[model samples]
Target: MLALPASADEARRSGYDFMSRATRAMQDEDAANTGMLWVKDGEALWNGKAGGANRACADCHGDAVASMKGVATRYPAFDARMRRPVSLEQRINLCRTEKQKATPLAHEGPDLLALSAYIGMQSRGMPIAIVMDENTKPFLEAGRETFNRRQGQLNLSCAQCHEDNWGRKLAGNPITQAHPTGYPLYRLEWQGVGSLQRRLRNCLVGTRTQAYAYGAPEFVDLELFLMWRANGMTLETPAVRP
Candidate 1:
């Protein structure tokens, strides 16, 4: 285990850094990473037609490998239409409604996870590079407040573990700095691909706090902050984790 640092930003590392070698190996090799199953599904979905427009994501985006490279790393980006920051998942839904003319995929569902994982894969090895500006500043501050605010019966804040005492063990699990570089990742506990929102909800529940509904603005705000916090970290879509 790495030594705990006093400062939250002092020794920033991916959750990947805290994993056991065996678990890391699972993530390192696509053949061993079960999350690839979702990536495969996403590839198919990307090419499949949908909705009134009968358009596939490929229709507009073209080859994802070229079009989507470094894209995920720059989200949650400011959306001028919404006047707030939108997550990558939210952007996908926007394209569906406005471009593809399809009903949005269910949150945390296989199709959403698959498509998100697929796009995220295109940015693999790229550094996170969220852009902040006047429009996104308020949301970023909101996210920062959420991270520091105490919640639930435990009266614990996210900073307590992730910021103040990362690298320490909690219930035999290492406490990692809460970075959002990898999403639509595979968690052993879930036994399937899941989104960062799912993980956030889990943490909220674990802290005995009320979890916001899926697609909540609060969740997106927090995601924006996390992406900013993890800026410069490598993208690791479909990452395997214990």
Candidate 2:
């Protein structure tokens, strides 16, 4: 059994810490990281002209290296128009429909994953830094409730495993504290890149629960809670997981 970290301050470990040395090495080296392939694809899409606007993300954002730095850390952010929090994926789709006059990318589709991974990469190593305000407080509370609520035939809440039983093994895999730092990552099990929602769906299915449809508000609320829980952790876009 893995030993728990000693205190609340020490409790928040990145999922990377639970990885085997070889997996950690894989995530460390870009050349070996399969997720970089999606990042490359995303870069191409970022520069390619899209939609009726005939504009690339570059047209408005300029050099992503500069413009997108630290941006991912603030997401699951409040959207004034929607009067609720929106995930980065939703934000991207909104830009597609509103600014680019393009149809939204399919949820969990390669193009969407590629673009998200690309944007997430720009903020690599930055701490998660979501701000809480009056407008976002209610949503945050809802997220917290979701994290703690028991559901499914197995009667499991996210906190049961991630918060209470972390540092333990489940089916030979170490159960680390749930964190949202390395989203749109590469999973060896999937043989490709995937979003956090995809992983969450897998968990819900494992627990014999009905998973939410992609882009559901419930998923976004849960994501907000996870990101807030992982506040101050470094971003590791395109992280490798086994």
lDDT of 2: 0.90
Poorest stretch of ten by lDDT in candidate 1: 1-10
Q: What stretches of model 2 exceed 4 Å from their correct place?
A: 1-7
Query: Cα lDDT of model 1 overall?
Result: 0.90
Superposition error at 115 for model 1 (Å): 0.3
For residues 125-190, write the lDDT of model 2, one tens digit per residue: 998888888888788889889889998999999999998999999998989888977999999999
Write candidate 1's Cα lDDT for 106-129 as tens digits. 999889999999999999999888
For all candidates in order, the CA lDDT equals 0.90, 0.90
Model 2 error, position 173 (Å): 1.2
Candidate with maximal TM-score: 2
Candidate 2 lDDT for residue 85: 95
